[model samples]
Target: MGLITEARTEKLMQNFSAIDFRMSIEDFSVRVLNTLTGVIPEFNKGRVMIKSEDKIYRCAAWKGFSDDIRNFQISEDEDPISADDTPKIYRNIYNIYRKALHGSMEDIMIKSGLPEVKVSVVVGIFFEGKIVGKVFLESAMDIDISKYDLYLLKFVSKVSSLFIGMKFFQERERRYHKDIIMAMVKALEARDTYTVGHSERVALYSVHIAKELGLDIKDVDKIYWGSIVHDIGKLSIPEHILMKPSKLSPVEYELVKNHPVAGEAMIKDFPWLDRIRPIVRNHHERWDGKGYPDGLKGEQIPFEVRIVTIADAFDAMTSDRVYRKSYSLEHALSEIIRLSGKQFDPEIAKVAVDVLNRVFPVIRNS
Candidate 1:
């Protein structure tokens, strides 16, 4: 009997068509693997392995095996998929498994409750003529696959390659955008020597705080980007005012306070940055309605902006300035705890201090 019938082949194609490729690469891989395995019964076990930059194939998605097998990898030299573009069948390759896994195949099968593998098919996924990944299927011993089954596997590989390639392209494009933004940050920092590395530190602190607050990856990512450019408006301020070693006059202080509003204006035209506009503009706003530009207070402030607010304040307190020395981590954290309800959101500030203490454990309770 063949792996799939004519009617099942149509059903398989329909399942593949429903895949949403716009998800993150990790998610896309799992979606493709699940759909492929769910629509076919001839295969009892399978996995998708993606090639890393080191030229090793690592398991990205799997089925019917302990997740511990995710650590299993095949070097380029040992991976048969690396040398072949078409589906190839291997029979009883126990030595191959032993070499890669450092154990007998029977040991793994017994431990993982996987049946002994008698026949397996490997299909390579390629993009623009370069091999990128593979799909390995463990076939049931009672069933024999025909040429049509191989053709269907090849079709699935082609679709998987296209989807995976698009995800890689999107990642590259995002990195390019971030590079341009970082250049702008460097330019701003060049003028204000006192705030050198301020944006990056705030971004780091914001990420830690956002994660501690239990925000999802997408929200944490937005907070990081917003924190990176939170002070971008300072670029428009006078150079002398920014670098002044003495106390700023009231007029100079007012100009300095305009930065958040100016930063929002700087990136407002960028539709891609629309999500972070509120964060850039309102990060300075206090919890008690005493902050600059607009006095959005309490819950009126966006949750993301609230997180950045604490991070921005914490970095400023702990960093060296032209006017005063940097505060110790312990002292800075003490101030954060003290002003929680007045300057920062009470809940987020508590989480931030706890997260920062863990990050700087040497100063904990000291």
Candidate 2:
């Protein structure tokens, strides 16, 4: 009996660990209930119900149980179980344990339809002091579970409950992060109304150029993000300068040109964004060391930044701006080719021209 208890304990611990390591809550619940049924030999059929905020126990995960039992509905309006309904073996246990061990309480119960099945086990899971879930197990053979097995079930329940809690917390964190990023982008958009779709357009053009260049998918995605946020530093510039109706003075132009550096600083602390920061910061740098902020020349600049810069410049020139009329597709393509090896990387400039030609075929003839 002692050896059997130890084996059951080990099996429960292993199942708990596996469930805890799962990436999704649905998968974790399914795996835990399946493993529990396997370890508890007397458990022929199992069903798991999770307590929702609506004060109802909803079906979460189940195995070896009919759809009707698995789909059984229970709500807060259902009265709590009376004292007489509690099983004799679970008399001294708490209400949670009574529901789990006896399978006859209102919170969690299992009624076997087959006459051959005589015993059933229900396990209630408590999280943060409240009974949050229950597992029902049925058996055809009469087998008395030891106290040790009961204790092991309680431990497994606690671990699985914590796993569910952590999953909820992680999902909330992801949404919070997404909300913050969107807010920042919206704020930037409000300040630079003329460039409302600038980032998105650059992203699209950069992705196309990257594909035409036969770049890897990872590199292509990096270019896409870099292009989108390349002008994020414009947020730091005053609205007057950003929306100036005339060409900027030399000093004003210098301030305006520092946006890449400012944008890099804005997103530098994000670990996932670290690789793209340099690309954002140096997108304006010229190949011949004549650009602002950093005059990184030739091969010194990152390849992804170079790709984004060409795409961004093409979109900027072709789109209508406060200080300049939109250039025709032919004019923009000619200007990009004209600046090759000086304003842009010669090789990337060639690829950019090819991409534009393919996208706007009439530009090639012009």
For model 2, the run of ten residues with the poorest summed lDDT = 82-91
Tell me the TM-score of each prediction against the true structure.
Answer: 0.88, 0.52
List the candidate 1 regions with Cα displacement exceeding 4 Å. 1-4, 75-80, 83-85, 92-94, 100-116, 139-143, 360-366
Q: Rate the local accuracy (lDDT) of all candidates.
A: 0.79, 0.69
lDDT of 2 by residue, 1-366 (tens): 234766877777776655444356557777777777767766665556677778877667666654444545566455242111111222222244334434444332333132334454556666555666665555555668766656656666667668766766675775686567567766887886667767767787888888988997768877876776778788889999989998789989888888888888889888767767877789888889897677888889888878887887887888778877889888999999999999899998998898876765433223
Summarize candidate 1's per-residue lDDT along 1-366 as a digit string, tens digits: 334476767777777776775666567667656665665667777778888889888888877677766766667776533325577887654445665556534454455433456667788877667888888776546457667767777777878888878877787888998998999999999997878888888888889888887899999989999999899999989999998998999999999999998999999888888999999899889999999789988999999999999888888888789888989889999999999999999999989998887765432223
Query: What local lDDT score does residue 165 receive in model 2, on the 0 to 100 scale?
Result: 67
RMSD of 2: 11.4
Backbone clashes under 3 angstroms, per model: 0, 1
Model 2: CA > 4 A from native: 1-179, 360-366
Q: Pick the candidate with the highest TM-score.
A: 1
